[model samples]
Target chain A: MMELFFKPKSVAVIGASKNPKKDGNIIVNNIINSDFRGEIYPVNPAADEVLGKKAYASLDDIPGEVDLVVIIIPAQMCVQAMEDCARKGVKAVIIESMGFTETGAAGKKIQDRIEAIASKAGIRVMGPNCTGIVSRDIATTFFPIKDVPRGNVVMIGQSGLLAAGMASDIVVNQSLDIHKICSIGNKCDVNENDLLEYFGNDEQTKVIAMYLESIADGGNFVKIARKVTPKKPVILLNGGRSEAGAMAAMSHTGSIASNARIVDAAIRQTGCIRADDFTELKDFAKVFSTQPLPSGNGVAVVTAAGSVGVVVSDLCAEHGLALPRFGAQTIDALKGLFPDFMPPSNPVDLWFAIEKLGMTRALEAALGAPLRDPAVDAAIVLLAGFEYTMNAVEEKVVQRIAKECGKPVIICTLVGYNRLRNRIVEELGRDLPVFTSLISGVKALSKLCEYGIRRHRFGDR
Target chain B: MVEFRPTEIHGLPGFRRRFIRTFSGIPYIDVLSHADNPAMPDSGSENFKIADPPCIENEPMPLNEIVARARRENRTVLTEIESKQILAQAGIDCTETRLARTRAEAVSVSAAFGYPVVLKISSKDITHKSDAGGVKVNLKDAAEVEAAYDGITQSALQRFPRAQIEGISVQPMARPGIEIIMGMTRDRNFGPVLMFGLGGVLVEVLQDVAFGIVPLERSDAAEMIDEIRGKKLLDGYRGQDSVDRSRLENMLLKLSAFVDANPEIAEIDMNPVFARSDGATVVDARIILRELSEAESARPVQS
Candidate 1:
């Protein structure tokens, strides 16, 4: 049933327009641009053709069976369109029209009417005010998203614009390897549980990031998450965590478990990682999708400056990560790279080494040695984007060592020229997870290590 | 004042079989209808005779009967005695509490349990016993017990005139130990969630509590115990003896099991469970039932 939405063979766009500026036009254009090799039928009584495709008067006018329908019409007219879809035996529908429940009482009544129709017909509805889905296989969102990478990460959100905006940013910047981004607004029928369960069993999905204003069914969410998280990491960013936000959630969904503590408990019990903000949501997914899970929580901080290493050490401790002492061989190897005055330790400060042996050699001995150490499960390598560091980025030294050691590594870049930093982000960021702040990098690595240790304890490969 | 006939027990739906199995030898199975007692009958001379100490080992508690009676009567709140009975049946330890219907019965019950007993007015209507001056703790002798009983009855009658006063619940004074609170509450979305925390100031002022969704695994129980901010206090703070952590974990697991088995229960509160070095004992308990919908009433109960 879920596959029909993501991999639909034929699709019909209700209220699809020929005008370039309209959402109906964008929806049709997005599907036309993507890898979706399905039949497209644009339903607009006023137009004979839409986006070079023949437009139909209604869903009944379409020739073949419609597997999926993307409705972008007015809110009041949605009941009629839904009835038409139900009569057409359309199993999947994404209602991108706004002015439903989120508006007021009259809107809620209309939504309820649409829900009754969908339920009676045994048809699944995604949203009443949402941008549907963006993936390599199909792009149903009104946002101009194209060339979506078939990455292993899947993002599920409740806000329509945020999910579409983030998808645009990620795709345009090529920051995170994303498989699909699903925005379920005013979740009338298809909820996080349905999508989560579907993606949990998906062979291609490795990490799932979710942003929910309210959970439709928490009991089922915990049950499914308990099973899915043990196999793959599920990162969650709860929107209504504060008192004010909880009040907002009540008005948004008509009901919510307003207690933040219980929500936190559910997250910890299911082993799903909790992300505090949007950046962590994206950053954690980036790290989990690209890097290998560490065997333990032991992290060796490899930094050019001592102060940054100290700050990272504190952050690591705060995030339940340990900065353990280096092993004898690792310490001995790092000592040879350091000057006489500075003794090598867990942080493995690399300013002297970088000045003496240049960027590549310093990283090879300083970052590479600890990464291969038996005592350290992961490493946080801090880099300052400078002219000298440009060589290492070009050589892919950090990326090479992280891949070779078969352990997780996160790089934090700070205090550098914009051009050099942009170069670093563009060059090394494509293959490795890079953060502008130490806390984000450390936090991401900590989540990966936490999941890794849990997996290792459960004897999962 | 209502004379309950033994033959009426046979009329209860699904109660005849279990009632016969549990109370076969016991004479005079007084079956009080919901009209007589809104919540449950008084402890001394009522249905399901109160064991002297109230801790009857291996005695199969009639959970279905109590729940059905409450639902039949349209009562949402279960009396404290009823709550303890349900908890005890789940294999969790609680202080032995028995009902005394009269002054003489209260004195005798306290004497049998030993001196320094606690007497609390056992009525479903009086949720705040202390506020209503219905609680008299640490009575040293029969004379004090007699006086306390009269005072409680008068004060409760004066406070809540229409309350269906069941009787006085008498239990031995539990030894001083670490005060812990553990219970379950139904979330709007999540079915039932269990909570663990320190009692008194730690919980009241600081609000330091940890929660877990129902059907918790043993590992989840351990994590919830360790998640609280005052978790270190559980490990023998100052000169106090370290609480039996495994025992606390077991109680939590048992509660999770009980909540999982019984979906009709809407909420439960077991506050001030004394966690001693040897074990933990629930001193007070409250269980609220979800209003019986047509679907829930028609569904077969899981034993």
Candidate 2:
């Protein structure tokens, strides 16, 4: 059922147009540029051809069976087009056109009519007001996101612009890997529950991140999430957690936000990780999608500066991730790499080692000590302004630490230069999660440990 | 009909049961823990006999009938005695309260309850007794009880002239312990959600609470208790005695069961649930039943 929307063999662009910059034209162009394996048939009565493909007058004119339909026309005309798609036996439809439910009563009536027509024909609709979806097999959205990073995280967002923003960040920054992006705007037909059920079983999706203003069905979502979370981590960032924010969310998406504490408890009850902000969403997505879950809440911090170590240690404690006191053997091993006068600790400050032992060896020892320690469950390596010698922080060392210790390592860099930041990010991000700030890195590790503790509590893994 | 099968999860501690119930064509699987089946009618557990059981025989009427009577009388709020009665019938520990309509009755009830009894004006209309000067706690003797009764009744009448005065309720003053609040409010989406917090007079000022959906399991109750910001206060903060956590967990489970069983119960405020080292007891309970519409009675409660 979900494959019809994601990997359809044949899709019909209902409002396909020849005019450049139009939603109908852009959607067809996206499918063409995205290397979608499916056959695209343009259906526009006014145009003879759209983006070098012959345009049919209507869905009836298309000879092949349509697996999916993208309705990009006016809201008032959506009902008729849906009926036509139903007649054509299209199983999935993505309505990118706005002015439904979000516009109040008159629009809601039309949206309800569309739902009735589609449900009677047994067709699943993505949205009456949405940005549509993007998959690795095919990108069906009109939102112009270029060179999308295809990885394991499936993002299901309620807001179209928020989905676009997250996709653009993943694509442009190349930080997080998003396997599937579905903008479930208005949720006239398909809601979070349906998408969660589908992607929960999706093998390609390792992590599921959602940006929801208000959940359509809270009880069922929690039920499905409780089942899905044990297998795959589901991280959600709720938009309307405050009263004023809730009011704004209502005006924006026409959704009444559930109480924050109630929603928080429910989210926790389902064993889903809650992201405090969009940055934390990306942070958690990067770690959860990439790194393995830590066995316990014990975190080891390795930093170049003692001040950075202090702040991150405090954050670790705040987020329930403990910085364990180093044992004699672990302290002895760490002290062997550092000066005799300076005793070794959990943080393992490498300020002197960077100058004495060079960046590569210093990083290797500082990170490897905690990673190799049996007392530590996870490791956080902090690097500051090592732009030129980023390769010195060997990927092999990080990978070896992960493989041997059966733990995850996170790196947070405090580089001021953008070129160096991007270089370090592109270099080390492939092996370990490279965070821009200390708090995000610590919090992400804390979140990973939280999932670890919860999964262990449920005896899932 | 459904059959229960014993299932063993490898390397796990508890005994698990898989119950498959099919309604229409959809099959629902419920994983239940069968650890420690609570023995009925005195299994020799601490104070189990003293607790009021569920109104099993139904001669004195069930909660639904009491709610229906209140609805017929056009009363939205239940009196303290009626509220605690409903709670006690659900097997929850509530303060032993007696409603006295006259001065003599108040003095006699206070004497029977022993010294250091608390007096509060009992009226269906006056929800906040403290604000209306209707509460007089720690009344030691019969003379003090008489004066408290006069003051409470006079103040309640002065506050709301049109309100009907039910009389004063006398309860033995509970020992000082950690104050916690257990409550339920009907959420628009998720029916009744239970809330736990560090409570008492400062509950409003503190506003530290954690909520959970009803029909909570033992693990759910444990997590709810640990989720609160002031959770450490329950563990004997600043030289105070630690609360009985298992007893608190049992209270939460009872609240969940009560909330789940009574669909007409719209809101329940069990404030100042005095938590001592031995067990927790409900000091004040307020249960408000659904009075919006007759149509609500047919609506299936969401779990």
Candidate 3:
């Protein structure tokens, strides 16, 4: 059912226009620019051709069968378009129009009529106000996105910000390795549960990050999440979790149990990792999709300065991560890298080592030894954004050692030159998870360790 | 010691009267038999039946009947006795409580259950018993029980003039221990959820509670117990005896099971449950029933 939306063979743009600024034009252009090999038909009464594709006056005029339809018509005309799609025997439709339930009662009535029509025709509607889907194979969003990398992470959102704003940013900046982004606004027919179940079974999808203002069906969500979480990680960011949000939920659902507390209970019960903000949602996905899961919550903090290491240790403890003592062999191995006056410890301070052997060799011994220790399940390498750190970033010293150790490693770089910092973020961060702050780095690593420990305790399903 | 047998009455076949021996080293029967009562009735046994002490061997009353009876009477709130009966049926332990319609019944029931005992107003209309002066605890003798019963009835009537007084409920005083609370409430999205926390100031002021969704696995229950900020207090603070944590977890699991089995229950509150080293006992309980819609009432029951 979901494949009809993502991998449709042939598609029709209901309101495709010749004007370059219109959403109708952008939708057609995005599809044409994507890797999609399917046929495209533009249904417009005014234009004879859209982006050089033959235009049809209506569904009846199209000669070939339409697998999916992307509707950009007025909200008032959505019901008529849905009726036309039903007559054409099209099973999937993405209505990217505005003025649905989010407006008021009058808009709600029109949405209800469309919902009735879709249900009767056995059709699945994606949205009444949204930017439908963005992926390497197809892009239906109004935003201009191209060359989407075939990455492993799949994002399911209930708002257009994910597909339009975030998708363009991530693709242009190459910040995240994203496979697909879906925005199901108003959720007239399709919802988060449908996409969760679909992506849960998707072989290419390794991590799922979701942002929802309200759950469509919480009971079904819990049931499906319990089954999917043991197999893969589901990171969620709930939009309306405040007391004011509870009031809005009361008007939406006409019930009292819509508070943040109950939603949190369901998340914990299903073992889904809860993200406090949008940054955590995306950052957690970046780390989980790239790094290996640790077997325990034990972490080793490796830093050049003692102050930053102390802060990292405190943040790790606050996140339920333990900084275990290094074993004798690992300690002995690290001692050889340190100078005579300085002794190696859990944080494995590398100031003297860096001063003696430079950044590349010091990190190779100091960071590599603890990562190889049996007591440490993960490592947090704190790097300063100075000219000295350029050698390590260029040599990929952290990346090489992290790969060899086979343990999860995150780098937090602060107090650095902007040029040097951007260089690290663009270079090392592309492969390994790198954060500008210690809290975010430690927090992301903690989520990985937590999930890993849970999986280790309860055998993988 | 007296051995009592089940007495066959006109229609009540399982009628029986059992003597309760006081663990507090006080003789209740002699005091009740000698106490003077001007308003006492000659035949107390005919009007009230002493509820049996809660034990594993006792046959649990049907839960649906308790819920249906409350709904039939146009009441959403179940009396404390009814709530305890429902909890006990779910395999959770609760202090035995019985309804006494008159002063004489209250005395005899308290005597049978032994002293010191607690008397609470059992009316559906009265929810805050202590606020309405409808509660009196630690009554050690018939003289104190008689005085406490009069004080409770008069105060409740003065407070809630039109309330329907269903007589006071008498139960043996539970020994002091760690105060724990466990409950279930229906969520609009997530069906039902269970909560566990320390009872007194921790829950009231700090709101130190952890919740788990219904139909919880054993691991979920264990996690809820371990998630609270005051969880370390459960392991014995200072010289106080630590509570039996496994027993508390079992009670939470049973609560989840009960909520899962009974969908009509809207909310349940078991507050100030006494948690001892050996076991935990629910000191007070309240269960609220969901108002059935017309379509829900018309649906056929599943076997």
Clashing pairs in 3: A385-A416
Query: 1 or 3, which is superior by lDDT?
Result: 1
Query: Per TM-score, what order, best first?
Result: 3, 1, 2
lDDT of each: 0.83, 0.76, 0.82
Q: Is candidate 1 or candidate 2 better by lDDT?
A: 1
- Per-residue CA lDDT of model 1 for B1-303, tens digit only, reads 323333323325555654444333222213233444433223323232432432222233478867876765557788778888889999989888876665776787788889999998887777667778888889999999988887887777667655666567888998878888887877777777888888632444566678898889999999988987888888989978999889999999999989988987877778779988899999877788876678977775543
TM-score of chain A of each: 0.96, 0.93, 0.96
Worst 10 residues of 1 chain A by lDDT: A247-256
Q: How well does each candidate superpose onto the true structure, as a TM-score?
A: 0.86, 0.85, 0.88
- The pairs that clash in candidate 1 are none
Native RMSD of candidate 2 (Å): 13.6
Which prediction has the highest TM-score against the true structure?
Answer: 3
Q: Which has the better TM-score: candidate 2, or candidate 3?
A: 3
DockQ comparisons of all candidates to the true complex: 0.25, 0.16, 0.22
Clash count in backbone of candidate 2: 0
